[model samples]
Target: MGIFQPLNTPIRDWQGQRVWIVGASSGIGAALARALAARGAWVALSARRREALEEVASACKGETRVEPMDATRPEDFERVRERLLAAWGRLDLVVFNAGTYQPLRAAELTPAVVRGILDTNLLGVMDGVAACVPLFTRQGRGAMALVGSVAGYGGLPKATVYGPGKAALINFAETLYLDLAPVGVSVFLVSPGFVATPLTAQNDFAMPALMSPDAAAEAMLAGFARGDFEIHFPRRFTLVLKLLRFLPRRFYFALIHRLTGL
Candidate 1:
């Protein structure tokens, strides 16, 4: 048998499920909303940009609601929560995909950059959890899918602040799963390899195993269908990273230097 069963529970039906996707203004979040809506899921889109959210919502086939707000602000989540509660009465799935990324090295590190990454990537996810946990616990069942990164698996060149923040998220999702799984709530840590999105477009180096946003979104839904806890994609790329994660520290550092020349 596989570690957590090859297929946990196939989500073959998506009719009438209310899914709230934060950061749906663009990138993977936008792609996910499009994919879910195609499958008949009613999606509530949230992001700081109302126009972007509305654009995505308008393109969807199923019923879509635009709830724009900043992920970094706690009060914004509170407002969105009220709207979701009033509209759907309950949320079946919450996807925390609101995040920002900037390539930084030790040479150019700044307190502002560090704090900015932590605030949006780490603290923002926590805020989403704080808002959703009570609702999920009250309902006795719900699911959370957080957008982490393969970059989180280990230290990478040009990812000074982004890497550590995502590492925290990976651990956070695992801890959430341990605590929430027993109560029927599922937690997923979605780690994507190099995907072509607005976020990664700023990268200077060649991105290996690069996939489109739509492809990444498809893999996520496929993983969700199987009720996977860690949903990573483009196995050709992610499998090697998974193996590298198990390497000894000395070997890991040496291999990273050899591969990335950083």
Candidate 2:
């Protein structure tokens, strides 16, 4: 790999590709399923909501299979993976995108809610990765994309528990890339700014550089085409967060306070 080159193999062609998305009921996941299917990829949609997954599949253009499963359950993911492999023979890519966000400050923190954040946002994805690693290693070629958040890049006020969960994903993805890349596996870390989805609808404060789910899906497609290790978008918003990480802690905290007014 060159110094300035992409870290993974470029996935420019989607024709006949097989993709499994763990959170495909609505928001960016649904939009991504539609986008990839339109581009001739066979998409498998997974989520707890079967009705919503069916709705998403109804709109997809190419082959789509609805595989509903709770991400936090290792057995659920294991069962679904077996079904998918039996049907498709091999999965080209799997995206762990199931997550939730709750607006909580220091005072509002509760053990149950904190556990909820940790379970869904962090543990769920980890289980999916654990379930797939052996399969991918055996296949000799596979890819995975973990959906992270810009909130993970640094701390924010309301994200209290949510922020920590996503921060863990960024680190997990980085480490997974190091281990998996040598074994013919491609790992992509997808970070997005506030996209107008049900997940972000709970926010009371004005969000910066907010884009739609469709737009977010398009950005992922572009990133996959370019073979980027970290697929973050809207660049205008995410790039600023990327730069903010370089600042000293005092300045960084002050800047966050000023930007968020929290």
Candidate 3:
């Protein structure tokens, strides 16, 4: 890759594109499905909720397939990958949007909760990557998107387990890109700001720069069209987090404590 080269291929046309989106039962995942389908893309929706995925599929235009699979189960991801490959013969893009977030103080963390977050957020994405990379290698082309969070950019008061899980994803996505990009594959990391969804409904803090899921979906598509490696949105919020990443640990901790009062 050249110094000024785009990190990935810019996907300007969605018409007839085949996109498999995991965790598409609701929220940004569902919205992205609808947006892509509207643009004439064939969308395969997967989530743990069979009925919910079906409901989402009903509203999506164009050809749609629904698969219910638990993210924590690697076998489930493999099975869905096989089904989608058999059905479409080629998957242009695969987006892993499934994640969980629970606000917890450090003391409130437990073994079960820690493992649960790691399994669903970090390991789940790794498993999905493993399932898709071989097929992508065989085809010599395919794109992947991993939906991370601003929480992953730095340590926070209430993000304890959830923050670490997402932080791992940030690392994982970068590593995947290094290994996969040379094979003619594109890997994107999506770190969204506060979005009004069932997931954000769990956050008690006054969320700054919160955007709608529909808006988030739009931002994501725009990022793909631009071939951006890191598609972070609501820049008013995310840019600040990005800048804070370079802060010294002591000052960073002080600022976070002062802002969050945790």
Task: For each candidate in the order shown, give its overall lDDT on alpha carbons.
Answer: 0.90, 0.94, 0.92
Number of the top TM-score candidate: 2
lDDT of 2 by residue, 1-262 (tens): 7898889998999999999999999999999999999999999999999999999999999799999899889999899999999999998999999998899999999999999888989999999999999999999998999999999988899999999899999999999999999998999999999999998999999998899999999999999999999999999999999999999999999999998889
User: Which runs in model 3 stand beyond 4 Å of their true positions?
Assistant: none
* C-alpha lDDT of residue 22 in model 1: 92
**Which one wins on lDDT?**
2
Q: Tell me the deviation in Å of residue 120 in model 2.
A: 0.8
Q: Is candidate 1 or candidate 3 better by lDDT?
A: 3
Give TM-scores for every candidate, taking all chains together and pairing residue i with residue i.
0.96, 0.98, 0.98
Candidate 1 per-residue lDDT over residues 146-209, each given as its tens digit: 9999999999989999999999999999899888877778898899999888999999888889
Judge candidate 1 at residue 130 and give its lDDT.
92
Clash-forming residue pairs, model 2: none
Higher-ranked by lDDT: 2 or 3: 2
Error of 3 at 123 (Å): 0.8
| lDDT tens digits, residue span 1-262, model 3 | 7878789998889999999999899899999999999999999999899999999999999899998999999999889988987898899999999988888998898999999888888899999999999999999998999999999999988899988889888999999999989999999999998999998899878988989999999999999998999999999889998898799998888999888877
| Clashes by residue pair, model 1 | none
